[model samples]
Target: MKHFIQQVLYALIASMLLLTACTKSTPIGSELIDQDQVELKFRDDFKIIAKSINVDSVKTYGPQENEQLNSYLCGRYEDPVFGKVEASIFTQLALEGAMLPDFITKEGTVILDSVILSLVYDSTKVYGDELALPQKISIHTMFEALDRADTYYSNQSFGYSPNPIGEKTFFPRVRDSL
Candidate 1:
């Protein structure tokens, strides 16, 4: 009985660690990935990551409103001759908490009059700046400054109104190249 109890405890601990480890970005390998795999993983993982974001309120922007996302098609070039340059083009908005590193970035914090979290995960099934996405993607909200009865947002001019950036679509090496 004691041995069985020990095994159960060990399993619980291992499962907890595994769950925590997966909350961050997905692991990528240099091996070539087929477009189908990219599409499947990108779609599935994106949904999962979006479900991870925690926000007081959410309002999805672009696409459904007969609009195109102002995504950024950035490329990384580090030649012994050419210098570093990065560019951002059309992109869309995402939900809170599920912000990823590669594709998406830290736009700013969002506030709301009430804590509405159900819609925080609905920003999925959409593409990022690029026309296509890569295989295996994820996002993390990381840090946040949430407060009720106060709706103070950093960049309220355009995006992040009711949505937070969970995942983004961008070049893998864009950040490093620049």
Candidate 2:
């Protein structure tokens, strides 16, 4: 019986080695194909409209009318033809759910470590030479709670501290990967 078990184990190991050796090492499309011989067809269908109109006055539009339009940050840009344009963003943070399982409570007084705010910029939406120019961003804390029932607009104003909580000066870098 001992000899039979040893023979079976050896046969199984040999089979596994043979299967692994037979497997392909490289992917199916590793070889390059000639692009000149391949004929690719492409088509683009779009329309562009250009019109000149006087823009003396403008009104603010709220989220109630257009639910899709919303901004959480504001920026200012100056163009040679368009002059100076200013924008502001307001946001509120909320807790998603209950405390995590690993959350621990200390017996004595607990001290705060540090608070961090991270902002991610969308590369595709960026305009102008952001790489060459450095931007100074100021973050202010809100004085009052934001109203969930009321619709917010770009031109609307909210109560916030006159002094900023923190400020940072940095150049924008496009993120390529996660």
Candidate 3:
């Protein structure tokens, strides 16, 4: 019985070795992929004139109406080649259910302690030095309301308070969860 079991194991091992040894010299997915489609052609004789152009404006608002946004950037980064660049965020706050006025009327005088602003940070989207100095952020209330139907651009001006309601300076830990 012992000799029979040993022989069976040896046969199984030899079978596996034989199966693995029969490998084609061609690429693994060569059968599935077309040789013509995956061909690479290089051209270096032509002069390449690479010049960066300034973008005048970009549509930043309205995901449901005009534009869609996966994420919003609000920070300042100084690139050695591109100089200094800053991004600002202008967003409209919305209630979960009833209107603010209606809620106030029904629930009497509501004592609001604080307004918490939560943001999910994307590490991959961050450019420049991630370990640079702490970025200063100022939050101000907008005088004009943002309409969902209207499209807002990067260069478009929205009336906001001169004085900031809240201000915070902190180092951005991009990899860390909020």
Candidate 4:
């Protein structure tokens, strides 16, 4: 009986030790993490000056098939330093995947109410310091579709209506949220 009691006491002690040994693993480098430190060095050894460059001829390239543009720009600006700059863009609109619902289609003579064109501006993609100044902009309808087969360049011209569809004069205000 004494031997059995000793055996049972040993089994209990072994089980208690096994239970105590089992513990959750701690992640490495998790204890008391230090904040990141950054150091910057500045040197003013040489004087910087702007130089004027005269160009006899300048060449421009067009957009390729592999390249993709996010926005279509159409505007003309006259800068004292950069001279006159003009840009025009063409886009294709299609409702391929977006189909009208059956309920909307069932209703006869669906009259259009209003159309609104919203343009989101990217602050980081600015070129000149004319954002604060109010500029006149005119929008016209394209007469022809942009050819997918041909490459388009900055100097290339597209057919557009002579009359302006809309015109606005406002200062560009860059915002974080649209």
lDDT of 2 by residue, 100-129 (tens): 335456865454555676777776677778
Best by lDDT: 3
**Off by more than 4 A, model 4:** 1-65, 71-77, 96-114, 128-132, 148-150, 176-178
Please, what is the whole-model Cα lDDT of each candidate in the order they appear? Answer: 0.40, 0.66, 0.77, 0.63
**Predicted model with the maximum TM-score:** 3
Task: Quote each prediction's TM-score.
Answer: 0.16, 0.50, 0.59, 0.47
Task: Give me the runs in candidate 2 sitting further than 4 Å from their true place.
Answer: 1-73, 97-114, 176-178
Higher-ranked by TM-score: 3 or 4:
3
Better of 2 and 4 by lDDT: 2
User: Per-residue CA lDDT of candidate 1, range 109-155, in tens?
Assistant: 54433432221112233234432434222233334434332343322
The lDDT, on a scale of 0 to 1, for candidate 4 is 0.63
What's the C-alpha lDDT at position 148 in model 3? 63
Per-residue CA lDDT of candidate 3, range 12-55, in tens? 99999999998967867888978877875798899866555766
Q: Which candidate do you rate higher for lDDT, 1 or 2? A: 2
Candidate 4, 28: how far from true, in Å? 54
